[model samples]
Target: MSRLVLLGLWLVCVLASAVAAIWMLIAVLSGSKRAWRLAVAHDPLANAAFGGNEDETISIRAGKAARAGER
Candidate 1:
């Protein structure tokens, strides 16, 4: 009876280890895919072509003042 209990415990440990390994692999794959997408989506030339210049300034305070004057 003691030997059977030991065997059952060992089997449970192995199954738990396998589940943990699979979960880690899935997490790593998802994070890598997200990093790849972010790297590909941020091109300065593409942003400029779409009139999204980083150097242009549209201040929040100025916008709020204009809106207040309009009202």
Candidate 2:
């Protein structure tokens, strides 16, 4: 009975470890993909995922466009 209990505990530990590792892997992969996309995309702030920036970023380019429009 003790041996069986120990085996069950070991199995549970292994399963928990595997699940944690997989969860971490998914999080890391998703985070890496987001970072890579942000690096390549000039949107900065990851606003593209939301409803902020479509073609141009407001923080960086909005000023220039505003100035051009004023002229």
Candidate 3:
């Protein structure tokens, strides 16, 4: 009788783990898609905040400065 109870508890734990893993996977995939959309839209602020390129490269900064000089 105790063996049956243990088996049932084990099964419940396994199912719960599987459900949690699936939920986490879905959340990650959804977030990645949203980030991709934001990148494709060229949202510099959002991209810099979430995508980890907070500092602009020297060349990019130079280009922007040059463009400003043109105006």
**TM-scores across all candidates?**
0.41, 0.41, 0.41
lDDT of 1 by residue, 1-71 (tens): 69999999989968975775565567567775554444333344345445656443234334655889941
lDDT of 3 by residue, 1-71 (tens): 69999999989968975775566567567775544443333444433655435465434555776889941
State the local distance difference test value for candidate 2.
Answer: 0.60
Better of 1 and 3 by lDDT: 3
The C-alpha lDDT values of all candidates are 0.57, 0.60, 0.59
**Which stretches in model 1 have alpha-carbon errors above 4 Å?**
32-71
**Model 1: per-residue Cα lDDT at residue 6:** 96
Candidate 1 vs candidate 2, lDDT winner:
2
Worst 10 residues of 1 by lDDT: 54-63
Clashing pairs in 3: none
Candidate 2 lDDT tens digits, 7-45? 999899689757755665675677756444434443543
Task: Please count the clashing residue pairs in each candidate, in the order shown.
Answer: 0, 0, 0
